[model samples]
Target: MDRNLAIEFVRATEAAAMASARLMGRGDERAAMAESILAMRSMIDSIECRAKVIIGEKGLFDGVSLEEGIEVGRGEGPELEIALNPLEGARVCSTGGYNALSLLAIAEKGSIFRPPAVYMDKIGVGPDARDVVDIRETPKENLTRLAEIKKCRVRDLTCVILNRPRHVNLIREVREAGARITLISDGDVAGAISTCMPDSGIDIIFGEGGAAEGVMAAAAIKCMGGGFQGIFRPKNKAEEKLLLARDIAPERVFDTEDLVDGDIVFAATGVTNGSFLNGVLFKPWGAVTHSIVMRSQSGTLRHIKAEHHFDRKPRY
Candidate 1:
């Protein structure tokens, strides 16, 4: 993929973020998601590339989506695979909560893992401790080993988990192991990404989240050379059927490299403020946006603060 596509991708995320920012606190996630998808699709369709959304967040917005395996872009440039989460945390965004984002990942054709959207049991950590943590080990054992590698006590470790009822035993084990927990309502991708960012103060992540989110998070981790491992968890017979129909193995552990292969580019624009990136800010002149774009081949990450003047620039 050409390096210039990184900036083009950010433009889509930025447009999605700006489009959804107005719907914050409106308690209408569907509307917010629809606006973001439409805005992003408009931008993506204009970009000069032949792309397929092999992995995407679908089923929201009354069947609106970038959609898995659906064609996007201008159909005139590089062949690419796109993984997208137009509004990562719509529930959080609707409630005016933390860590809402519009983000996507790109790779050459056949590089990204294609999975049916299902729950995935996962473990994530930074580059320093990436080699130490193991998904096959018990949570307490993993935490103990991670603490040893970090040269810190078990109590000093903080793990992120989704606040779901299914995590009851997992949460108990982490607490019993003497590690603190950060429970997030949604947006585990950001939570998982935090583990890879040293200043983020997040040591590791453990629990189940969306499979699409796992791939998106894994792409960022792969770019940073961090650690992430996941296995599919189908909740019901229908879900199991959907996964099995695609020839996906539930028992296989998907590491960062397995999730995203070859060189990759990822872009994100914050819709609401949280740990790493600031949310879009509306002003009299226009709006200010905070975004970041990264590439694995060159290991370059760029933080952009863009001021959009509506009078001069038009919104799609």
Candidate 2:
């Protein structure tokens, strides 16, 4: 993929964030998601690349074209695979909560992980704590090793996890292990990526989340030289069958490299305020967008804050 497309992709995220922020706190998740999909799809089609949707949304909020195998882009550049979530946390956005964003990952063919859309048991940590985490180990054991490496007490470590009933045991284990916890409402991609951010107050992430979002988070974490591991967790016999048919072993632990390794591009624009990125701010004249664009080949990450004029904005 062209390096210039990094910024171009950010444009798509920006457009999506801007469109969705319009309905923030409006209690209309589908409407906000619909606007985000349209805005993002338009920008993606304008890009000069042959993009395939390997892991994407389908049949919800009119995002049918984002389904797996659907081809996007202008059909003119490097053939790439796109794993996208135009609206990562629609419920969060509707409630005016945190970590709502528009995110996408672009990589070479066969680089992004795709596993039948089942939930993934994932562990994400920054580069410093990378060597200490094993999903198979107890949270106490991992946290102890991490604290020893960081030269901090066990109680000083902070872990992040999704606030779900399935995590009741996981949460209890972490608390018992003497590590603080930050339970987020949604946005697994952001939750995982937060561990890589120095000021996000997140040291590690452990829980089950969407496999597609795991791939996206792995892409971002790779760009930041972080550590990530995911194991396919099939919830039913049908999903296990899907994995078997694809030759994907449910026990296999996919590291960050296994998930996304080649030259990669990741872009995200915040839709609602959060620790990682600020939400879009609408002004009397127009709006302001905060976005981050990353490229793995050069390990370059750019934070872009742009001011948009209502009448002069480009094709949102």
Q: Where in model 2 is the C-alpha error above 4 Å?
A: 60-64, 314-316
As a whole number from 0 to 100, the lDDT of residue 72 in candidate 1 is: 92
lDDT per prediction?
0.90, 0.89
> Per-residue alpha-carbon lDDT of model 1 for 126-186, expressed as tens digits?
9888899989899999999998999999999999999999999999999999999999999
Which residue pairs collide in model 2, if any?
Answer: none
Tell me the lDDT of model 1 at 115.
67
Of candidate 1, the 10-residue stretch with the lowest lDDT total is 56-65
For 110-184, candidate 2 gives per-residue lDDT tens digits of 888776647999999998988788988888899998899889998998888999999999999999988999998
By summed lDDT, the worst window of 10 consecutive residues in model 2 runs over: 57-66
TM-score of each: 0.95, 0.97
Q: Pick the candidate with the highest TM-score.
A: 2
